[model samples]
Target: MNVTGWQRDALLAVAEVVVLAVILVMALLGNGLVLVVLLRRRRHHNPLHLFMLNLCLADLVVALFQVLPQLVWDAKGRFPGPDFLCRLVKYLQVLGMFASSYMIVAMTVDRHYAICCPLQAHRSGATQRWNTFILLAWGLSLLLSLPQVFIFSRSEVAPGVYECWGNFAESWGLKAYVTWMTLAVFILPVVIITVCQPGPAASSAFCCPLPKAPTARGGEVSAAMSKTVRMTLVIVLVYSLCWAPFFSVQLWAAWDPDPPQNGAVFTLLMLLASLNSCTNPWIYSAFSSIQLYGKLINILCLVCLIQTLYFILYM
Candidate 1:
């Protein structure tokens, strides 16, 4: 059977919408659960837990602002709203990307400081320092995303047809913008995470050592620190894996005159980038205590079951 071009495009659009919808639901459920568990805990003051909370918030932003809006745009086949909405959505989409990337960097750097500079980690005003890091991560994200507001607007791309579009300079503008975004959002953060992560031996020695004392408290602390380090590493690894291809594709499309914009492989890779938001909560839950993991598994299963039924009936 031969499929027409329009039919193929329709299939692609449907696939994209389904993928985004799944990503949005998983991100909301997983991160929402993580947020609730963190908030309910008496030890919410723990620096690692606080960072995880912020990370979940960042993932929620991605789900709500980035994935959700894109899903709508895909379904409608155009941007649907006023000029203000167009700009606002563009701003938030980039903001989510920045926040998610930097939050992980901040978390990794904190762990590095704790393991490499134990004295500084335990010094007075540690809580304030951690708060400062969190504030800086979000502050930078907000500040950096301002460009989206000015660059993107509801524009008349065709006669009597308007869509949310970016205004870039004729020749060099798009290339420059994409290059800068790739650097700011992905490249630089990966460099920081790489530098901050210690080797396995060093991490093991700093985070967990052979039991010198028979006390359970000492063992518990060692185990907790080790788990925290491992968890942070996993999150960073997953983030890099998920986003690297997206940024690479963006760069390629921007620089190459005849890029593979319609390539299925490229499109799928870009779509899968948003899966990072969905994976963070699960990674944290897996590393957490058995009680926490059990709680999350139950809710996660329920959400999946409900979503499955909804898709079968409606989608």
Candidate 2:
């Protein structure tokens, strides 16, 4: 390649590294704080809080397994680990994605049950039901992500150079894999979330009729439940917005003969999909108490200010 081409490639790598670094830090800090706070409060009995805790845990896994490894790969210009590490990382990366996606779906389904079927939701053993949902979410994620271990491995791409890559059948393997991932990870979960999110104006034609609260205390309970439902809805919307471009690009690159694999826009979209992890904690904070929201805002401002100063001084 020419000097200009080499320079552009180096610049893009640097940009990717910087972006991933920022995402990794934000995701870690945001999710870590949420986890700590929730655990300290010892509110696992609240099914919503239990889901939030697991969601944060899943986001942390994405930061560590998915984004961190990608950052390292970008900085090094290749995978810098053994075949085992490569396979493990790939499995955990997809595992985190699946866990995060299905956790949201499970949470939404819980809300749907509470709002639409109050009698069942308030029945005995509801906690057991929630626990079952959480277990299924994690179990399915583990099962689905096992394919990554078989698919990705360290391989010699050149005479002397090795990198982590996927082994696919010659003709249709990649296309099928990407399509299945998009369907399982993105499309199906989105459809489930959309159907579960009850509208404010519940018509019999669309959502199940919402039950009325019987007393003032029950009204307050309903309001709190509504807040959580709203929070879950925002999470679902943000997840879709952030991940749609990523899966779309993956599908296009898999199927299109002349895909824009090196296009700046597509690359940026994929990288910024990690921003969903960063935004999730803030979304939860926003829907939480005012005091918690204030604290989170302070933390976020401090992070942003530090990042800005570092860029100004070093970049």
* Consecutive 10-residue window with the lowest summed lDDT within model 1: 205-214
Off by more than 4 A, model 2: 200-213, 290-315
Q: Which stretches in model 1 have alpha-carbon errors above 4 Å?
A: 1-3, 42-44, 200-219, 290-315
Any idea what lDDT model 2 has?
0.87
Per-residue lDDT tens digits for candidate 2, residues 1-315, read 699888887888898999999999889988988888888877544887788889999999899999999999999999999999999999999998999999999998887877777776667468888898899999999999999998999998999999999999678999999999999999999998887787754324454455655675887886898788789889998999999999989988998899977767778888867888888888988898524556667888999999999999999
lDDT of 1 at 173: 91
Candidate models: Cα lDDT each: 0.88, 0.87
Q: Write the per-residue lDDT of candidate 1 for residues 1-315, one digit (tens) a residue.
A: 346767877888899999999999889988988898888884646898899899999999999999999999999999999999999999999999999999999999888877666655677467987888999999999999999999999999999999999998678899999999999999999988987886766566555343343655867876887888889889988998999999899999999999988766878788888999999989988887525457767877999999999999999
Each prediction's Cα RMSD? 4.7, 4.2
lDDT for position 222 in model 2: 67
Error of 2 at 302 (Å): 11
